[model samples]
Target: MPVPVVSVAQMRQWEQASWSAGRTEAAVIARVGACLAAWLRRHVPHNDRILILAGKGHNGDDARAALPHLQGRAVDLVEVRDPETALPDLERALARGPDWILDGLFGIGLNRPLAEPWCRLIERINQARSRIVSVDVPSGLDADTGRPWGATLRATCTLTLAAPKQGLLHPAAHTFTGRLEVIPDIGLVPCPIQSELCWTLPEDFLDWPPPRPVAAHKGTFGHLAIVAGSTGYHGAAVLAARAAQRARPGLITLITPASVYAVVASQLQAVMVHPWSAAHPLPGRYTALLFGPGLAAADLPAEIPATLARLWQEANVPIVVDASALDHVPRGPIPRDALRVLTPHPGEAARLLGTTTNEVQSNRVAAVRALSGQFGGAWIVLKGYQTLIGRQHGPIFVNPSGNPDLAQGGSGDVLAGYLAGLCAQPPLQGDPERLIRYAVWQHGAAADALSRRHPAWVVEDLVRTLGRVAPHRVASTARPATPTTPP
Candidate 1:
């Protein structure tokens, strides 16, 4: 299913277009209301009392419209009004007993913090035992950014209108929204509008890396080189190499300080190691290279640019710069036409872009694009709750998988390694853009798999989990001389 995520402003424009084309709001609402009633009847059954917390908005109208069709079932309506007009049915529901609450108090257009009466009522609704269901977005959530305005109602489910709102999947909005479902108001006008909630599932990355031939050799999978770890951070390097190996790379190379090479080598049986020193230069045959992840920030100014330049000049390898490596290169005009990928958290992204974390969070699409463009159109993965993937154009995707349990150290290292391995595959080629898109989807999928079976997920687990997780498989046996366009 194509998950169309749109903003409040776009939704309004779509509705206006529909209205201009002669479709009435009441008619659209009636058809949607009937669907809601049918779904409610199937899910909640008859005789169950439903308490709808209705605001003065159209969302309120949607809840009110459903009341008549409920038929003989007990309905409790809580009207939140200022200069009150009378809706007798609403009055009856307000006076009724414990029931399921439908929170239609506010839509995504609400920019200000919630005011009195409504705030108090939200508190009451929270305390009630009834399961709360939001109509569009949870009232207090900022439609564009997912931050709560003041207090927001926690809903068991949110029946969002037309399409999924970007705010619903925001990390900050997790408290309010539950399982989000989009119901298309199909009778309404269809505008040529794109939604903000663009996400990729395991199925979406199907064409990536292609498949291997039966007679493939070790070098066929692609040679992966990882430059990571200091004395204390060997775990970071180990996790990255292991993750790459798990992703089925043909060969693996680890470049690190001499102090920890033996330990890293022993810990990782499959990956080869090279000591990172002034004496040794990186090999020219590597298919992909991953730098950073425990690299000392103090050494970045001298070594990073030199290393990046060498990687670019020596081999046409797709490179991934992550963790401390981002410190190596700050946000500025980068050399053109390089195969690079940058994975940064909001704080790191802010530092690179010369802005505050707040600025990065405010408009993630802009930040992602800026970083990508400044650095030769490198793939940018802005890691957060709704991880935004960037291209030179804008945010190409916002991943909605994984869980809070994944909030641990070394996860980024695992991701860096995951991308490196994917880059090495024969089918994936040296396309940094495609690598970022597919790697992020697979990384989140692995985390999602881990979360289902356990608690307190670790990054090392991600390294081990990759082989168990399947990549999208296609039937074409011929390794096309040219890159296949993403389906």
Candidate 2:
């Protein structure tokens, strides 16, 4: 199961409760130190030179406690505010050029800006060539907001204690909190039972692509219908269809505007393409529908609203809405029985909410929840840094796998089509929420994998890399594990 992300205040509350329950502060600090030291010994080589920057508070106490276990190495420990010889000690340590620097300075509770000497020290740390391991939250970073308090230490890895801080999951903090590791069981217990946010890890997808029968044919997998593309944006439809193909849907039929039909048809040999028309009824046999992506509002037929209404009301299949299709959502409340998923970036979400992008980005959780409620139990994927997936009456799923490489155009279209394809698969049918989550995971996982080879990757690269990922298969009769927390 994924772990909960708590704010600094919540963490403090938990710490106080633990202390009242007989775990003393000193004892907690000792355990954290021991665990951190053990983790370091296991991951870091014993021969590497180490420098420990200790502050005056419990963060420093934790680092001090670890000294006993980190013996036999050239380790230098400097207390930030020590009056006698702190500066000389720091200078000498810097001169030695330690292989690793363990930053135990101000932690999550810090809210104020850094002072002169501390600021200088942080600047030096940032300039250093040594790898940095930050204990708990990195110094000079707001653990609640993921914003830097001034000059913050950029860590090679952050050893977060107990639960992950809510701020660390913020997209802006990814560079500073490189490769987050949550240290479990450091005297903090009885974790908050419910939280608005939870982070997704790779381990959560260990049982993906649930097994299929050997005797099954293409028809057994299921088919999907994609309504996307316009005159100039034919590439959008091609990307979506190609990504859907990579996801292994049984069959894909694309309904596109006549202006772009020939180009899209020529590019895609496997997918069946049909020119969209209001004169004819939409094909109704597919198990899932993916709407939007490259469609132009000006070019939509006069009867499109009625056409969409009919498909949504009578088709009784999962519909994934994105891009231009989102512009046409009925202004009134959606039907309670509708099975729909809306994949919108902040701008599109803001348009649906009649608000600004700033408002949507500022309070993404509330925006997604409001969308779900207003749509009468619809599922929503608010795509951005830490892409969020939420359904009516369900907690948000925070995706932690994507990077800046996915910030380009047409990425959301690929995500929408990929999700639609997953929904069309037999194993994912009737579970719109899980289907969306798994698709989001796969989308980011592929981007993450491709980023290691190239500095920048286009949407097509993501489509091609999807096939290289190894799918975990289970017994045909097996079911996906129910997440402990709300999924």
Q: What TM-score would candidate 1 get against the native?
A: 0.72
Error of 2 at 398 (Å): 1.2
Query: Across residues 81-140, which tens digit of lDDT does each residue of candidate 2 receive?
Result: 652446777878889989988899888879998777777778878888999989998888
> Given candidate 2, what's the lDDT at residue 440?
90
Candidate 1: residue 165 Cα off by (Å)? 3.4
Query: Which model scores highest in TM-score?
Result: 2
- TM-score of candidate 2 to 2 decimals: 0.80
lDDT value for model 1: 0.71
What is candidate 1's lDDT per residue for 1-487, written digit by digit as tens? 2345777777788889888999888776666556556546655747778886677877777776666666677776667664134334444554565467877778877989876655665676677777777887877778778888778888877877766777787657777787555555436776557754465544455655566788989878888888888778888888888788877888988888777778887887777887776555564677778888778634433564577656644455677888877866544444455567889999999998899999998778888888877776777889977688877774377665556666889888888888878877766664555566677767776787787678666777777776465643211111212211211
Whole-model Cα lDDT per candidate? 0.71, 0.78
Worst 10 residues of 2 by lDDT: 474-483
- Tell me the lDDT of candidate 2: 0.78
